[model samples]
Target: MNIKYSLIKKEEDIDILQGKESTFANLHYKYNKETIQFLKTHFYRQDSLYLVATDENNAFVALCSLDSDWWEPHHFFLREIFIMPSYQGQGIGKVLFEKCIDHANQFQAKAIVTETAFENIPMQKLCEKMGFTRWDNPQWKEGITYKLFL
Candidate 1:
């Protein structure tokens, strides 16, 4: 599949975004308008939100967001990373992840952090595979948080 990358700018991309949200149950929202408004506002900044991959038809297949100012003014946070069901298990997540890592490096970020709830084992495993170690605890009973030096 051809993977196209572009900045999500128009309102129509919201529908494609909502459709892709099914892969991430944490993103389930009762009202899409509110969800759109929230994400559009908080994630529009450059280097924060990015559509890193698209399919042969130019439809988005994988995407992610990085919040650079969360922990401190200089640290970049990998807030949200999602790949469509059709694109999962095809190394799309890794590509998107590496892209975010490059973004962190470019920003001169000291560290990159990401969090996932207790139930998301897939994410936890992926984090471990990506060389991220647990912080604040070992069991991760509260939640899974990962940091990588940038």
Candidate 2:
């Protein structure tokens, strides 16, 4: 498969990135209108970055969204990263994550942070493989936070 990676640019790309059968719909939004609106606001932000991986046919296979931390100016937070079920074991997620790490490094970010539910072993394993350690803090209790220092 000829997979290509690129930063999100057009409105249509956002639509394609938000696939119809996405399991992340609840976290992002179930409706296209709301998703588009949210993307518009965040996609253009100076401190935010969004990347997508597409197949030879230009169909989105994965996506990663990140933004600067609100309280920590030098830290970047990975908001989302998803790979289509068909493409999950093909290393697309790892490629997208590497892109996020590159983005953080390019921006001179001190660290990259992300959060995932305790039951999501796959994500936890990915985080660990990426050299991220669990971030323990009292403020966050709903999920575990992972941090990778640059």
* Maximum-lDDT candidate: 2
**Steric clash pairs (candidate 2):** none
Best by TM-score: 2
- The whole-model C-alpha lDDT of candidate 2 against the native structure comes to 0.77
lDDT of 2 at 43: 72
lDDT of model 1 at residue 121?
Answer: 72
Instruction: For candidate 1, write residues 33-95 as lDDT tens digits.
Output: 666566556465666755556777776676676766474567777876777777777777777
lDDT of 1: 0.69
Model 1 alpha-carbon drift over 4 Å, by segment: 9-15, 23-31, 137-142
Clashes of 2: 0
lDDT of each: 0.69, 0.77
Assess the local accuracy of residue 46 in candidate 2 as a C-alpha lDDT between 0 and 100. Answer: 80
